[model samples]
Target: MTSDDSRSRRIGRRSYLRGSLVGLGTLSVTGVAVADESGNQCPAEEPDESEEREETEESNETEDQEEIEEQYETVVDVVEAGADPEGNESITPVLREVVGDDTLLEFPEGRYYMDEQLRVTGFENVGFVGRNATLVPATYHEFDGPQYRLFRLGTSDVPGRDLRFEGFEVDQTADETGIRVISVEVEDGLVVRNVTVRGVHDSGTWGPGLFNVTEPEGEGIVARFRAEDGAIHADETPNAGNMWRGATGIVVNPDHRGTLVFEDCSLGGFPDNGLYASNETGRVGVDGGRFQNSTTASVRLSGTTGRIRDATVVVDDDPHDSNGQHAIRLDGGDHELENVTVDVPQPNGDAIRIMNGVDSAAISSSELTVGDRPNSGIRIDPTAGATTLEDVAIDIDGSANAVRILGEDAEPVVLEDVRITGDATGTRNRHAIFCERSGCQFVGLDVEQVGGDSRRGLELRGSEYVVADSEFVTTHTPIVVNGGDDVTIEDTVGRSAGDGYSLRITSDSGAVGLAGNEFPDGVRDDR
Candidate 1:
């Protein structure tokens, strides 16, 4: 029989039983066959192969001495050259020769196209590995519903296990609706390394990396929307359209239970976001990735237990075009950013910002340099949660305030070792640091501006400060501690050209503790 015919015959039985005899039923007696007299037919018997095997082979001792192997889904092996695999020159025939409980399908250095969505189900360790093999979309414009996943785990009827899709590219051109998913369910670890996906949307058709799977009927995929479970790639799926986050690039959202890893990958040009993990309760760890020119933020991880380290996020280059954007923005949830460099080189932009219920983003040994624009370098914009800016340098090279901490009527935000500086080009009333309506602790702060448009040096309004041994210097007033209670400006110093006050304390009944303070106007009380 042909390979297709054999596959047709194997899966033809609706409810065939092939499990070991030990699992037949709970046996009260081990060897006794307590017959069921309910007119049920006998189990399928094995064909007579002992006589033919004895006629051909040597002895049972020789056969018994051979390698002992268990029966499993055979892996259909195939190789690839530069050209297509026809009947002779192609590996498709050999792939067809695999025949159900078959051999492995292997490809070495070439592009392949599958007319059917390669279903790798009902078998343990049924693997498809490619040594730099690219699998292009192979179908007409109308042949796309759920049959284009480069390799899948579960299907309409069959559940999969111990399967792997290693180092393969599911490329799309024209009607490349990406990797369509009836339900991509895997049993073993789904490892995707050194793979690239492009053109998930070709005009009318669009596709995502993967989707959740439900059961065969309609009662299985109900839990697909639960982001609290883990990543968005785990499900017992029946059909398509379940938690399909519109991701076109190397996206991994496996339903909160799937551990999707992207190690040393380059992500670019997806209309929403790159390396996106929204509402996934699992930890989305990203290491050594370059996210540039993404339609949204370079990395948008909204999950509570997500992390981003050693990454570069550049929003735009031109000064006139940021489209009113800010690079490296994290909103909502508890997270960490270690060794992150957010470089916003455009106008009307911010380098790093944490706002709207964002908390516990400890900045350690990282640089946030906003280009010469009329804005603050770094901002914690009015969130009730805790945002600690520790060891972060906000160097804005424009006439704008270097860093604006706008937590008006919000929670306390902390800033430590943050060197905020403006360009030495224009000089005026722009600020190097502006904190308004917020409560923050500034420790080890170095604020400098040479020939700039920084107004009033460091301005504060309704914002209490715990200033200790802080140095603020400009061509204007050194520090403005006004409109707050319990404000302390101790061990502060500033230099002015002429007509400039050393430190201006505007709040009435406010006591200024003067110790080791150097300024042009010496206390006006004539100390």
Candidate 2:
């Protein structure tokens, strides 16, 4: 196995839902039992040494017989079933005749040309294994299923379950193909491992994607996968009947109601998105992956509950003023992002984006570095529900604020132990943290502006907030309150390099209260 494949397997068992379910309360509709008092959502109690030894002995005895049966169980080979290995003719007819339920179909090492979309339906426990094989699909003009794809795993009349595809390379570089690599709809256990797609797609329909899962009802795993330069035509003018017009790499459709796990997958230079899971009722868990270079968000997820842990998202290219193109976009409620790093070096790139309908989301132990742009390090839009950001670090070298909260619907957002640093001296009203929403709280926040024309460290606009036990270092104003009701500032320390009030309240509102704030005697707010 490749090194990446090994890493995928090693992290495969550590699911985000395991042991961390309690943090999500009752968000999960599947009714998986709440974690025990021991707090193990996914218990990992291994067998003892004696039990291991007995199992090993039994495995040793049956290994040879199992291997014999496995070899004998090979139901069909495409080449033996009238498929041309020299890429001369279509293989769909021959493949359809031999594929069946509980079948182990094999494709030997050869270049097979496909003129039509290969589809299977009403089957269970079907395995497609390829050994050093490559599938070269037909060009757009000659390809069958113009609105379809290269491989379709199920149909509405006969939705397959427990389908596996492994060890193959789909070469779309030879022609201007717009076909999706593999599309599947499985009720349970959809596994795609050790697969790579090399090419660009120009589809007028659903743009070409490496793997597309329409409706996954159970656990879906995609590991050791790579998609290089597979872009989408979704953003082009007047999209046709192609449902996935903007799909790039792996897309789990919004109807999914299961767990989608992506491990050790690498995607580069995709346009729309990479590794997206968009079902509000489903769960997406990404571990050990790299996503970069997209016109839209690299990793966009909208699920009921999910986690993006130990992952890296970087925007190394010039964003070219692509608005709303974030490194990571999390629209799912009750989701968690831990130990993830996002680097947005583009001009208008945003490191992390949180949008509407997101409630009880948590971002902890993560670092986001944003470049010179008009976007914030993290943006919470209107319609955002209760959220928490703890133990997070943000570094910005831009005209944008480190954190920006907008609209009235963003309420009850908490920031605890968050550190934000700005590289600019002072930008007018550009703050380390800016809030336009009500009922927000900042606890244990540390903000510093080292250089540039940036002014305030924290600014509140028409919002009710409580600032407690926070520290601010700025060149000018540290905190500003502009027309907010029931605002409380307590137990905070401020250090300024310029002669400005540490606390600036623009409105003479009776709802603003201050207590236990420390500043220089000459520069303090004594009102």
Candidate 3:
């Protein structure tokens, strides 16, 4: 028989059995007996009413039990589990007793109070979700000892897996009140989202949040997390003697090993650093966030490999006890910054500082603005590795150099399609582009230093450099070969509206080759 015919026969048999069993009361059988052993037709016996009633009762009981289990299978509502949701009592004891692995603890719409930290570790598939829930933490003195965090999900040694904590509002607006809403360490798969802290962190304790992915192959994401009202100085808070400048907005420390991404977050002014993820050995990513007015730096990131894309860092206002406020500070690692916007109008440090021990760094499609300060728009350290800046525009309103390359032993730096337009009015007589590193290339540069009389365009002090396809407009000498050897400036245009030379070769400089260049003023060869 064909497969289709066999399938149709099977269907016909099933339909015949179903139709026959509908009339056979209290029995469900696959087949019916046609005759007895004597070859005479036999009739089916009827079921006893007592046995049928008992069976019906047993089936109903089984269904009821299954319904109860299905209702409480994966979710545990905290309010129904002896926890007060009206903020009348502490939920610590109830939480400690009810939380377990492979379950989700959900909070209904209410104000929940926490007087101590709730710690859970070495768990898998644990989650805490809230529906319009507000967490109220006790003040610094009222909280339990080591009163830093509201919830400590896991630790470095016993990290959890597949952890999720989301959808809660933290209320720390009371006087002398603050909290780290959630500090989670996970081995793999973490999602923390939509957690907002509603007040300044004045408790002088830990920050609003701390996240770490403990395994190298793990991954985590923190999205829409905001701590807009930042922290106060530790000395200004009730817990004065315990900590340094108060809490940071968010922190990921050196113990991190896995990749962590902070997405679409917002942080306000803080006493210490903001979004400080430096000193890590993992991959850190900051995508589409705003970090503003934090001491040290607003956004500091360093790791094995890191990226800051579509982010904004603003240092327009300084704190009361402010120190140096760099908009973005990158440390040892391979890092890239793309589509980043930085405004340091009241700058105390460099807008962007690439420190030593970087493997490779690239800043592309970025806009940087610095105020009238001594720091540079972008300062590359002496020991940093190969660096490239492409499609970058820097606006300087101070005496800061638009781009400063420091140290002779630094690797070759490349600046392509960079535009520097600013007035260097500080007394330092800074140039638009100042280079002390050798074997660098500046291509497609557009520099305009039209503010101060002593402002120059390109000051080359290193050797074996090339400046090509560039244009310079300045009051002083547009191109100055001060101490470089075998320096080439070709296919370029230089203009000076003042009485300065278009190109000046200092007496102590080495050989400089100029080709296919237009100089409205003349060149002065002092070599």
lDDT, model 2: 0.69
Cα lDDT for residue 67, model 1? 17
What ranges in model 2 sit over 4 Å off? Answer: 1-74, 203-205, 208-217, 232-246, 318-321, 347-349, 425-429, 462-464, 511-516, 521-527
Q: Which consecutive 10 residues in model 3 have the weakest lDDT in total?
A: 22-31
Ranking under TM-score, best-scoring first? 3, 2, 1
Tell me the tens digit of each residue's lDDT in model 1 across 363-477. Answer: 6667777666664566666763666777777666767666667767777667777776656333433567777755677777787766544345676775456776677666666
- Score each candidate by Cα lDDT: 0.48, 0.69, 0.80
Candidate 2 or 1, higher lDDT? 2
Q: Enumerate clash totals for all models, in the order shown.
A: 38, 15, 0
Error of 1 at 510 (Å): 4.4
Give one digit per residue, the lDDT tens place, for model 3 in 1-527.
46575455334322322222222221112122223445454554445645543542343223322232222226788999988999989898899988886567888899999999999999876768788999999998999867899999999889897676778999999987788899899986676777999988988998998999888766677877999888888898888988878888999987798777787789998888899986558877787789999988889888787788778999888874676888998988888888899998888888999999787789999999988877789989999889999999999888778898888978989999999887666358558888989999999999988877467888899999999999998877889988788899999999985778999999989989989999879999987
Which candidate leads the pack in lDDT? 3
